[model samples]
Target: MDPLERLSSPAPEFLDRLAASTRALHWLVALPVLLLLLTGLTNFWPELKALHVGGARVFAWLHVLIGLGFAVALVPSVIAILMRRAARRDARELLAFGLDDYLWLQHRVLRAAGLRSVGPRVGKFNAGQKLNAVLSAAATAALMGTGVVLGVNYWSKDVFDVDLVGAVFRWHTVLSVLLLPLIAGHLYMALLNPGTRESLRGVTTGRVRRSWAERHHGAWADRVREERRAGEG
Candidate 1:
């Protein structure tokens, strides 16, 4: 088949990417995080501040609930990672960046800017995904900690002073701002980028087109094939 036809054709087979547990955990946090991001708009955008005070307060509390639920949603994954060896290995592999990951990213940046560049081999995850995962974990921890403090302050009388609450609020707001781009870029790659849109099935359904996997994750895809053959033989 021609290169264009091959690229455009439906894949002949699919490969498993995420486990059932992982996909469930993903949505558990994703839904609430989306709610938090939507409600969080009131906290930053200047025009939204002028909305009805009562409505704004409602959103503010709703944000708190969502944030708390987000943290709660992570509990099972955390425990499973700690207790299950395979989960730990998967987490480490997904998050850690090696030399090739750096080189791959360098080439990607150069190519994106229309410069000549040679790319390195890609594994199961790319540098961007690894960085996103790291940033996401850090953002989760930061938001959760600051959120708990702020939430506590909201319900109690004089438990946390104004200055302390203000400081925590600033950190929370700043972290939220930083997380926005990561979310946007992630969505764009999954939903809009033709090269990657096919992989969305891997996240949602735990399987992706074999052709898509081989092209984007050659190293890992080859290894999986090798392991499968070895097991069968």
Candidate 2:
């Protein structure tokens, strides 16, 4: 088979499975986050609190329930990353930001504005994606931490400082609000941007057009191709 043909073919079989697993994990985490946000937002805006009868009570109960699910959903993914060597390796790469990523972001910004035709070769996750992942993870951690404080205040006695719990709630709300735009941008890129929409296949079908991978994630594609060749040999 020609190299170009290989370049446009479906990703390696293992990658498809990995993508599918991680995608499921991602949705597991994302769903509860969405639920918590919707329920929690009503509590944040006083006027909106009256939108539904007993809305305050409903939102409070739903928020805590959803927050529990959100925290629990994170555990399986963490366990998977720890148990799977490949996942750990990939996670490391994803977390490591370097000079190439900086260049990629610069090019990406210019390209997005229609000012440039090309940019640096991106890896599996582009710079923006990496940064978004980091920020989202941070937000999740903060929410989880503050959520525990809120949970304690609700279930237990006033052993801890009431003022401290209040402070935690404020930070939690602020972090939640900050994450909204980041999540929105991620969704828009994955679902709307023509150039990036195909990447969503990684999460959906655990496969994507080789051409899409080559064009958008050139560095990763090159690594994939090399690995394929090595395996064939």
* Best-performing candidate as measured by TM-score: 1
Cα lDDT tens digits, model 1, 153-222, are 8677479889989999999989988999988998898898988897678779988878878888998899
**Which lDDT value does model 2 have at 185?**
91
State each model's C-alpha RMSD to the native.
Answer: 2.8, 4.6
lDDT of candidate 2? 0.75
Mind giving the per-residue lDDT tens digits that candidate 2 earns over 70-180?
676677767874576656655677799998889888886888788955667887888887899889988988989899778767666576798888898799889988999
RMSD of 2: 4.6
Q: Scored by CA lDDT, what does every candidate get? A: 0.79, 0.75
Off by over 4 Å in 1: 1-3, 6-11, 45-56, 81-86
Q: How does residue 212 of candidate 2 score in lDDT? A: 69
lDDT for model 1, please. Answer: 0.79
In the predicted model 2, the residue pairs found to clash are: none
